[model samples]
Target: MSPDQAQAQGRLHDTDPVGIIDIGSNSVRLVVYERLTRSPTVLFNEKVLAGLGRGVGVTNRLADDSVERALAALRRFRFLATQAGAETLYVLATAAAREAENGPDFIREVQKITGAKVEVLSGRDEAERSAYGIISGIWRANGIAGDLGGGSLELVDVRGEEIGDGRTYPLGGLRLQDAAEDSVRKAEKIAADALDGCSLLDGGAGRAFYAIGGTWRSLARLYMFETGYPLKVMHHFAIPAGEALDFCRKVAREDLAGFEHIDVISRSRRALLPYGAAVMEQIIRRAQPTEVVMSALGVREGHLYKLLSKKERARDPLIAASEELAILRSRSPRHAGELADWTGRLFEVLEVEESADERRLRTAACLLADIGWRAHPDYRGEQSLNIIAHAAFIGIDHPGRAYLALANFYRHVGLIEEELSPWIRKLATTRLMERARILGSAFRVAYLISAAMPGVMPKTTVRRRNGELVLELPKDIADLDGERLRKRFSQLGRLMELSADVEIA
Candidate 1:
């Protein structure tokens, strides 16, 4: 059987050491997983239809009863997770929580009660994780996979099971219902345009379509019922495109009664089946895949799989990737490397002692500091911000971390855009800011060092001197640039409230 079949049939290994609690629009679910001798295995999985999305479209707040029920479920899952000895309890809140007014507050409450700090994911995160899961689990070869949920529909590009960059459109069934007609048309245009723009589908002339989520499953079920697909299983079943399109068109024109023959689609979901199927039809028309498969695993499984992977647990993936990317993509790797070496040396004497881990992250920050130049010299800084914001690096948690890293990269040019200043304050702690500052300072000095390199310059050391501070450099190094290095350190010292003096060695 195919991976999709195995997953749907619960035939694959189920031992999982990680636990994930997914607070979604329609329900709250928790899964505990451990690694078996075989593939990652699921230990326990349970779902409760808390309907956190109920009334959210109109009220813009999670219903009180829904929140209570959801929290109760989480409170129980907390025990199960702990009982299973889960070290990393990855808690994620989807559309329901992200759009609610008191979402952050409720998240804090859950953390306090369950000891699970929830990472309320944006729709993009939802799409990205789902995409990764599809790649890692079912379609490891190459194809486009999509997960259409009650809250949102996520589109992904896949190379077999390997995931590539994908985009998310906010055209979920619930959201589509709330959106204006013009808005719906605009969203369709945007989704199609984005899909067409992506290069992942370039070589996917006629690949299988791996579908996941309730909407797709429902559509596939309706097809199975109508076509009298011998078995009820949809994992590897082929729903022909013509019949699939026809079924969708028929459903689109029918009332709720037209779906009575299909029992798999619940009464609650019957009304939205037409719209959801319309989305399916839209993508299928564009993709023109040879066949379609359904996925039973998505975000929860993806979260578990990711945590088990060597990248997230054994080492930091982003730092590792950044180091390699820096060397491969930098305009002047040699110069950049030399400047980084000098910067490290200068930083040692500069009073702030960073840990090995901090230094590693800093090195990564330094290496990719020039990546922005790839886009355009004039807007390199902006490009840097975008790369950090969207790149699928190993260790990043949210866009804020990327923003923090990118902001430091821009500081290499000697100016911080004031508009981003508030975000820096809001997002970063004092320690994080200091690290960013050190990285910025190191890069700036490195740039100057490269310019004066292959020529005799000064040796420098920075340290705390008599409660104040001073950077002492060899006379030749200090004199070559005429206090250029000293002035920069002095500015940094002042900004960080440390009085600094530049003394000739």
Candidate 2:
């Protein structure tokens, strides 16, 4: 059967390690992933700024120093990938390699030294692949995906799995800076002129503009720092077009002072921040995207994503990640799955009309609830809170991040006399906040009844009759019940505005 057919039939097992090396205009990066699951986790990630695109506009060739530095970096990367047990390696060279005069010679040397064939991506290839990465990373995304590198920019209209109308421009940070003679206004005009020719992008108004690249990521970091946005996760961080345009204009002129978290950004990355902002400004103004969302996945991720079968791509990334975490940390993966289904009974008794999204989040919470057992008993809640809140999970936004984190936190610690961090509280709406507390309290009650053991949770039943919420503990485990269980049951009851009653069969 074909890979897609195998995946759809649930016959593919992608446990073998894969490696990708992305050689771009500004930096060379190596990423080793544990497996090619729905939410592939990075086992090792490192990058070096070789500035291969530096002066490429003027020299028509990769810089000599940059080439030497990049070669050295590649040697290290090859060795590291081998040591990491990567079964196969894919080396991708972007704009600098494709546009420079000596690009072929540089590729030959890289092949000889690294023993990996180099694939130079055309502008259209880069744009389309980047759009795929965005699609794989987000649940439902439609807009223009703009990938800014040091040497070139790739723009494409993207909607779900479909990619179309791609175009490449010399509006990359390095290339634009040279073309505009380091003048922001000149750069703006050039960007506008280049963008104007793309009639394909005329309808982007009020839609998303997904920003993908290092310099743009830095800009997002600066924005997060300045705004003091609590959730520091970058994958789905979004800003209104108007607000983003103002910030871009300010950063385009090198006025990035007073951002509290500016120091966290690298000096080399900070230098190109303006060029990134400048290009973004024109795109937002002309394209009129309602919002600018920063995407953490780009070309390398796109390559990996493309290799996945359609069936695998259809799996929910959140569930895949939660299941993996359960296997790695929880007592039994079966118990986690049991907890997930048992919680539905608890919510049903509460008369909560959970939306589809809420149901998904609750299931995720169940899978992840017991993963924090390895941490100190005293701090499992906090540790789980931090890890879930900041995990590299896709298909969930910042608010949902808080919801999962808080749900797991509650699972560890009962809701009474406990509070979430202020930043986390801000991420969840009041309704979601209440739901999290309810889920957490219910989790505590279930944990008490099940003792975190497998096959026990399935016997727990929650029912509401005559306007009273009733929790029934199986007769076999009646001895395990205690005041803590009753109190947690009561807490869950009050959360849903019902009187708590537990029956020990």
Candidate 3:
């Protein structure tokens, strides 16, 4: 059924779907998202590096070849988006589309080929939107955001919802590369000179430098491989200023082709790497940010964020996505809510010191605990793991992602001999890993008693007594006190390193 119709019938899909076209200087791309939330998940994505800005710097016009390629991509994008059941397609044209002399003509052609609404963003407009993307995604970011596109660069100061004035410069990668004639030193000089007037650099000191755009993400990926970083998720990936400066300097000075993990660099993106680095080097020197935190969201997400109400923007993306999944797939949504609160009490009784983030993950796990109930009994754990691992979840980092997957996996199937891969182990800490095991054990006990049906969990009372964890079942629900339930309760106690006692009252 269509997603809208399904939702109306109280059968929600795992995700909401929307589409956007990013028309930039270097490429024109189409991104279809699973939903529009603080954390968006991509359902389908395609990009064509049309080099629309290649000659614009010198000739002040869009190249004929690039124009044709962009238009062709747009035509295909409309059909693909429609077939994907996207409710809206937001076409955002950045620097090149608004800067080049022939930009207007190109936009007209695009509008004709694809009858979707188009937005041509000025540099300031792009900067503000980029800030909104970061603000909406991160918990509470207080930093200077720099988004490097092919045609222009945007810098803005953002803290929560109070966004400072955003400015746009012509120091974008492709534009700077052309102006510097491929000289790394010259590119550095141009970048430094451009930032001389940006007062936002001063406020960024000791704060984060939230890097946006694809080039920064690619750079983060390279850094991840080089360091053997345990978690490879790019969003919220942080690097100290000193380390980032060193990396950028090397990229600016040498060819990445000679470096290790160079294979990660795409051909279309390689030549522009040095230019991106040059921009970074200047931003680092001027801002002296405490760290550089990479953001996967940008102008497109910013546009989406703008459309959201204050209440929707306030909801944690991870929690909202988890709750939505449960409502759609779980037999009883009320049970998920009950499990979350039950686990909270369990944690408090055990005196577990779960940080805010840990608590959030634990609550989400409870909501998603029964996602694989319909799967084959023998493979439900594996099925649930695979689904949650790659699901359209955002906000949670890769390590945290592993924690969620493992917790849900063991929730159904016991922690077997060696189902977890080495990579998964590396994704979380010893503490986080143990929490998963404990949460899984608790889920085991809860399910063995309630069978995941509603009303029974709330009737059960769990409390910590003199050197033991006691579970008191109501006399009315005494039918749940089966041998398997007893065994599972004791197993949970063993996992928690305490004796478990169950009694009917």
Candidate 4:
């Protein structure tokens, strides 16, 4: 490799690329993450549907052809993991591998091929890990987390950081499909029977039900496409219980090919949608959750989260992710930190009433404020908006994502509603929209004063005194103030409904 390539590789090595081989009943997936941070970024990810538990319910053994396909995929994944510089590899086998008669033998072969210890999780173990994945991704997750794989469904209760014992059922898509002979009516009966009188779901009443697994994600995607949802993000996508129940009933009972946007789902996954929907419909009917929230993270991410120290686990995932981006893409990470503190102090002086969650979102926006500086001056706003809107960020919902994106866009392009997309505006509340404009205006003023440097912002102060917003610049940097700075400060003052002044202190 060239010296520059070698140097880049060395930098990546410091972050520690970790690989996970998830052997599920329906698919074998390999995901190599850039690092094992709270909001882990994927370096490479690939999956192959192997249907390892196709007939395990009746046959009690993994299918021969399915085993061959899984092994082939495992071999390729092992090589790919090494190529991606993954020094650590974790192989986790879910319901199919633990239940099949030949599961032990299959696991041995997997260990040999991948040169890693294979962990065959029990039903409870699977549930806990899936719940941990939810905890890692969502902020203070509560309610039941159900992971519906091809072989089994693991349900566990979570309240904040506490995870309850989980129960497993044979309601997985492939297993249910086989048990019901591919009949939707029969699938519904089986799902009802499996979930009937399950005390684990009792606590989920009036709370959220976090859905995991590919089939459910596919279902969520179909929902997004059908509703013309503005944001395409899947994580934290929420559907009201009544609405989800009705939708699931339709998906389970109706013909899949007839759906308007059925093409959004892969053909391989289409056959199992009815079965998956049947199971989800039963859960919502029985649990009566307030809403169904989709989670992109699952067993793999959960397993990695378990490896962190208590201190690391305590950090806010959204802040950690934003800081990482600022370090990688901003003109100065230190300046971003300073800007966050400066804005925070300004908000307090202006008596802005902000909730704890709103404060966190604002800090994250500040860290991400300058990531698009390298883009063409004219298109910087558009590029920043698009990138932040669609970034693979967790611990936040759709509205929070919109706030971050809109704040940065306003910072770059000025606070003008006409230039913003109505679709983006639809995601945030009116209060959040106004707050975004205030933050963006503040950023405009800060950048002008600091030139995106570190030392200046810390020494400057913005305060409200005697019916005016006063920006007190330290005398040494007083000359940095200009007509453009005054105009930007005035814009911020207008947003706060206060007169603006600049004073040399």
Candidate 5:
């Protein structure tokens, strides 16, 4: 295709790039998304920690040095967003700019520099946006969502699609650090006192505590590193309440430098770790949640998600992302959709027990099955596995991500355990591993029969007969079935502990 044709095809169903310039208490960030998608893809993301809220606790004014740094960052961000083809730029300022005495001056300067109207979010607005972010990223999220920023903490109750009014506290990392005079004990007391008898957290008992913002994400990263977790994906990383409480206590009271992985964190963020941990410890103590879940989404994503139509908001992020990938990379996107239906029918005929969530994952895997077809034959599985395993996907847990990646891997490389990575295996349960194998085996058989095309797989049928799994090919395509297909079919049957045969309809 010509350059123009290629570009036109690429932008067919894609919306114009949208940019978000978030001026937070701790950092000034610029994120240009591919579009206002359910699962927005970050085309460009950059942040500068200007400590905009550093002196706000005591002086109640945005510091001069921080203001200069922030303004400089905004100027550059405006240029970068334009270069990135961002059609619209949404500028949002949180706690620092809203609370500080000199906040209005800073906002005016930002508006002038970026040539965009700045929406200084109120505490309630911040909390609501953060909650919306959790709703957008996590499927059927049920629990309390908390965003710990540099200047404040926003907490709100979330139950599926319903979100309660948000409450804000002055328990931000920088604020707490300043209030406690860098003393861990005082910080702990301050956090405890602020969150004491907070009704929002009271509703969080036995539910999830979704942690948002950079400081909390950094804290989760530390935990992930310390525990040697297999998948590095941050969203939906859950830790039990008891374990998280203990870890937070250690981080709050103990010396952070004593930890071996402390070096992994940025030096700029190291000082605030204790404060963040202290606040988290207080939250856990108060809420008694079932688990503390980390959410990478926050006010920025929430704001974007709010702009989407209600119908668009209701789409499953994982499936939408998977289908988008298939459309962009697969040989035939229609074939991928057909593959999903075909597999569903096969599972139904075979009486495979699949939960609603599992079926959703299987369908996502089907959509993504052929995404790696363009890679070299020998390395297709490895390439596809890496892409899906670490893709910027949301709404699915790590185990589901593993299933999708493994199914495609198995489709390309066959169901061979020896070739799989041990770390990836550690992420999924035994049941999921087996399901991946079965789906992979199914993909192998389906692809061999259809040649990655549409219509063929739908026409063929698989059924159980006389204690055997039989694959029936219509008379017209009977010549297409042979020893190779029979061998693949038998391999699939062996995994299910059944004999298999192929016959002409």
Candidate 6:
């Protein structure tokens, strides 16, 4: 491989894109991420449900039909990987391949066809990856990291940050349903043996069972639908422990027609819902977590995390990445530079006590604050939201950072959405909202001041006057556009709970 290609495939730290193809019993997926010093951009992502393990458990071999379907998908993935400029292909195979007789031959054929070697993961490796995925996304929990795949289930004990004592069982939904009841029980016992006396999980007893994998996520979606959660946010939605158990109970007894209401749940998964629910219920009973935090960040993010840490160091990778992207795509780099300098100076003069990351995110917001000018002048707010919402920004998480960016952009165009309130609420703390609002309002003032004469700097500083924030304009500024500036300042002052005034000779 060339140096550039080598770097792209090497690791996320190398500031190049990387591709990962995960071959599981139910589906085949390929993801290409453009990794930067702080963030990762998803260049391409798609999945196909090959059901590679549909009948592998009973047959003890991958069916000829399944092999053909998987091979075709792999070929398509190869094309996409190359198109994405991905230098390396990391292929991980789960249960079906590990248990099937023809699995080895299939992997070899794939290597010949796509020149991408497939690594058939042991149940342990699969469990480890699942644990890593959970840890990298959510807070480290003292409990079992469970991932239920189509053909098998793996559980790993995670204590603090370390995940150890993993075991893979053949009693996955598909496999368990295929086997005799006695065999299923036997498989459960074998799985139970792996966690027989692990201490890490002892702490989790009566706490939450941090649920990971498609099965539990499907359940969470069902719960969200039932509860009427406005947004389909998965990363931080905490389903009460009792609610999760109740949902499991409902799924365990519900018939096929019952799941039709869930927009994302498929008919194919209907048969497995009861079994998957049962698996979760059992785990929940064993290593109880405080609540089930549906992890939106998992294996893919785990791989990305491993890659990013290998890159340059940053206090918060997520924040750093967002800042980098904002700077890279900023349309007015020069204006953004000026805005940041002025904003920094203003904050310093005001004695703001926010952390570096908070300051950085604000600076980033100012940089991309004017990107909407590229879109139609009338609907720049809508255009700005779309750009930040869907941009393939290297190293930034979608929604979270995008919301912060949009909040700033909307200030320039006037806020008009009830929908954005939920997103603003997801910022973990209300203080974040307050900060964004203050910065956003300030940006609006700066934008208006700059709109009249692009580079004209305000002569006076902003300060608390009586009960309002008032801008003290320079004599020349007051003479040129004093009234216009005063009106703007009064509007902002009232909105931000302050007063406005200007002193001119």
Candidate number achieving the greatest TM-score relative to the actual structure: 4
RMSD of 1: 20.8
TM-score of each: 0.52, 0.93, 0.90, 0.98, 0.97, 0.76
What tens digits encode model 3's per-residue C-alpha lDDT throughout 361-418? 9989998999888899989888898788767566666667888988988887787738
Clashing pairs in 2: none
Q: Model 5, 91: alpha-carbon shift in Å? A: 0.4
Please report, in order, the local distance difference test score of every candidate based on alpha carbons.
0.63, 0.85, 0.85, 0.92, 0.91, 0.65
User: Which residue pairs show backbone clashes in model 5?
Assistant: none
Candidate with better TM-score, 1 vs 2: 2
Per-residue lDDT of candidate 2, residues 1-505 (tens digit)? 2354345422224576689999999899999887777787887899999999988899898989999999999999999988776768999999999989999999999898778889899998899889888987877788999999999999898887788888899988988888888887898889888888787678798799999999999999989988889988999898999999999998887566655678978887877788788889988888989999989998988898889999988888888888888877788889889988888876775777799888998899889898789899889999999999998898787888888988888777667434667788778888788788888887888778777889887877788877777877788877767787788778777777778788886
* Residues 268-340 of candidate 1: C-alpha lDDT, one tens digit per residue: 6665676666676667677777667676667776665565545443334445556555655666545545545
Candidate 4 contains a number of clashing pairs equal to 0
- Model 2 RMSD to the real structure? 4.5
Candidates sorted by TM-score, best first? 4, 5, 2, 3, 6, 1
Looking at model 4, residue 105 earns an lDDT score of 98
* Winner by TM-score between candidate 6 and candidate 1: 6
Per-prediction tally of clashes: 22, 0, 1, 0, 0, 13
The TM-score, computed over Cα atoms with residue i paired to residue i, of candidate 2 is: 0.93
Better of 5 and 6 by lDDT: 5
For model 6, residues 250-366, the per-residue Cα lDDT tens digits are: 776666365656656876666676667776665665566667666655556655565555334333444454455444555445666577767776565445567765666666666
Model 3 spans > 4 angstroms off = 1-17, 34-39, 230-232, 328-331, 374-383, 413-419, 494-497
What tens-digit string does per-residue lDDT give for candidate 4 at 1-505?
A: 2354357722334456899999999999999998888889998999999999899998999999999999999999999999887879999999899999999999999999999999999999899899999999999898899999999999999999999989999999999989998798999998898889899888889999999999999998998898899999999999999988999999998888788999999999999998899999999989999999999998999999999888989999999989988987999999999999999999898888899999999999999999999999999999999999999999999999999999999999997789998999889998888889889999999999989989899899888888899999998998987898898898888888899989899
Query: Model 2: runs farther than 4 Å from truth?
Result: 1-14, 257-261, 416-418
* Winning model by lDDT: 4
